[model samples]
Target: MKKFMLITCFIIGGFATAQAQQTSPVWPGCEDAEDVKACFNQKLAQHVRKNYEYPQSEDGEYIRGKVKISFTITEEGKAVVESVEGDKAEVNAAAKAMIQKIPDMEPGTLNGEPDDRNFTVPFNF
Candidate 1:
């Protein structure tokens, strides 16, 4: 939990370990948010909605599926996708792309030291 960026929306549900972390990431534009976790989720939702795009398959149909993405916020405060899992490779790739668009923020901390934080988000397309 010391280095986990847990969230509410599309979160890795049951990832209660984040509770042990010293501090959560200070999402960009959420520096003043009273509840860091809530703000993170809200901003994440907004980011997903703003960047959401459905990829087209070769068959001329939109790819529709769900993807689970694992990402890490590095000690340098940058979001990087760790992995993506989904039924369709295209959905997984698109989901990863959207997550990569997340802006950098103040890194989370553990034991008073900046640390890499991991977060999981799910996307339906």
Candidate 2:
């Protein structure tokens, strides 16, 4: 018999708040995307998968947990982590660092003016 483990991370999903009806920020290659929101979700999933690093406990065992990450995409198109909620501090920090790598994207609009977009998404590792 052969046995191995697979490590993976996934973004559960997120929303653009009440003003979601307005235009959404565009991901780098999603400029021409027909549905910007869907494109953004796909890009976010890819970002998390590529950047996530599993945290290890003091015992050297890989830690597994779900974190609710709250963040804002500023009017300047930067993604900033506001908070990370989880049972483990290590997991929280790892999740935060992973999300911090989200590349700058086109700023979303509210009432036709550049505005901060808030997103609360859950991630599993």
Candidate 3:
């Protein structure tokens, strides 16, 4: 009976710890939001729409492509773009530049400690 009780306590404690560690980063102006993930996505989309600028084509033709960007939000709440993958050079460069301009956010926390969080965004233009 003692061993069974101990095992049950350990399982419950582990689940509590796991729940405490699962938290998402807060974006600027979304600090008070109840759902950080939804708020972050909405703000990110708005930021992209506000900052994105189409690259100038050398041949005066419209360029259309998709860019996949991966970046990390540092513990200090700054964005550092890691990679921008796209078929067009201009698109990749534009996506990277846009991501770099993201405003600082509240750092994510895991187990109540500030943690670096990675995010990926896809831009189609």
The collision pairs in model 2 are: none
- Quick one: best TM-score, which candidate? 3
* lDDT tens digits by residue: candidate 3, 44-91: 999888988888787887777998899999988899999998999988
Best-to-worst order by lDDT is 3, 2, 1
**CA lDDT scores, all candidates in order:** 0.86, 0.87, 0.88
Tens-digit lDDT track of model 1 for 57-99: 7888998998889999999999999999899988888888888
TM-score to true structure, per model:
0.79, 0.80, 0.83
Give the residue spans of candidate 1 off by over 4 A. Answer: 1-21
For model 2, the stretches where C-alpha displacement exceeds 4 angstroms are 1-21
Q: For residues 10-33, write the lDDT of model 2, one tens digit per residue.
A: 121233243345678888999998
lDDT of 2: 0.87
User: What is residue 41's positional error in candidate 1, in angstroms?
Assistant: 0.5
Ordering by TM-score: 3, 2, 1
